[model samples]
Target: MRFDISGHYLLLQAFDRTGRKVFGGEWHGDEAFARDTEDPSGVSGERRNIQDLIKTLAASAEPHNAILASDADEEEHQAASDALHQINRELGQLKERLATLPHVTGSWLADHEAFKRRTDIESKLFEAFRSGDLDLQVGPNEIVQWRTWSRQPDFKVLFSMSCVIVPRSHAGQRRRGPAFIQLAAFEKWLCRFAGAATGTEELTPEAQLEIWLREKIKGPKEFSKPVYRAHALEEIPELSARAFDRVWDNVVPKNWKRRGRHGS
Candidate 1:
């Protein structure tokens, strides 16, 4: 859209499917003159047309220049929109991965205190371990605690993760558990190391974790089916009992149920 002030009046112009003048009149900076120039099809509204026209005129000295400037502005806007969409897409993927991580709770960054604490942990971990100097090991079971020194400060860390196997329902059913527990833990460690080494705090913990998981770990060679549904039960306190109850219902021996139904 473009406009020019000539002979003490404003001339409005814009492009459409045909770029033809749908309506033409004199606007006196009042409501009635506005009504006179309004096109019911709304190829352009008075206020927006005027604003766009002003912008167009400010960009260049000639009407032809204004058209070129408007086209450039539109192209720039489209480029920005595409970039924003890409960022949002990547963010959604990060959130989904973060959701799969064990011990993740609440809407990401919703709780101020919890967010700060998590980020602090991420920062500390990144600082202590990014160099790959500290000795690290994983065991088959039971939580572990270790002490590490970095940044002229000592941090004591206690952390554990394991897959809770869900056995098959029938006689020949296979066992299953959530798949990403190990991956999540690995990513978490990498993100903390990144925070410490680079002093980058803007990226979400999840995004940082993803970068390290992909680049440093190169992912696990074997992929497993993830039991994502089980996480919902764990997240809501009211539903936690249901998870255990369902497991007992399925896994407890038939004789145990019969025995309980009858007597001690």
Candidate 2:
């Protein structure tokens, strides 16, 4: 992926149990990401080794003007763009594939004591959070995540988490997963969408974490309510090795991997 990995930005996010932003900043480096050779799945990783560990992160760690000589030419630049496109496509496919699992709300979880979902809102809690109805807030940059809240062009919320987490299950065979939306963005986007008079009071990272923990423990129905089913990508059947090969073969140009095709 390095073929096109250069020059692009990444918004790597991290939050504690209470969904508070302990640290947040942009990460910029050609060598930012270390290799994860052991990860069976090609999705999220366990931790970051100090390249820049914080609560919020953007696509490129370095600002644009700062990368003058280091930036690639037009063709090389396109390759990076293409790489991002491919990564995003994989993320999309995985998200879709995981939509059929038992999940809970709160992008981050604390209590493992399972509960049941309620029909109070006439919809699931996750849907509500994503609907901008809750008007959530996360992190410093205030990236919001939702379709209805898409009106704000500068809003940087993640609509759904492309990654999957498989927890130690006591509930059943079904894998547990949930979509995530960052704090600052989620709140800001909701305010924009709902046209709220006053934006939310900025809370310290500790306070923010408490808010998120309260919400998670409270469950989907504003507290203590639970949502049983959710989008669980890990449970989705992985593409057969052969299928992956075939897709790659079709996607890669014939000559890209051809050496002995002409009886050389």
Per-model TM against the reference: 0.15, 0.16
- The root-mean-square deviation over C-alpha atoms between each candidate and the true structure, in angstroms, is 31.2, 33.3
lDDT of 1 by residue, 1-264 (tens): 111111010011101100111111211112111111222223224334544554543443344344444756777656655655564565555555545544423432234333333334334433433554322222222121222222222222222121222322211232322112123233334433222232213333333323332342243222211222243233333434344344334323343333332213
Which 10 successive residues of model 1 have the least lDDT summed?
9-18
Query: Global CA lDDT of candidate 1, please?
Result: 0.31
Model 1: which residue pairs collide? 126-192, 126-193, 127-196
Which residues of candidate 1, in runs, are more than 4 Å off? 1-110, 140-264
Question: Which 10 consecutive positions of candidate 2 have the poorest summed lDDT?
Answer: 113-122
CA lDDT, every model vs. true structure: 0.31, 0.30
Per-residue error at 233 for model 1, in Å? 49
RMSD of 1: 31.2
User: Across residues 100-191, which tens digit of lDDT does each residue of candidate 2 receive?
Assistant: 33243342121211111111111332454565544333322222344544444433333223222233332135332232434433443334
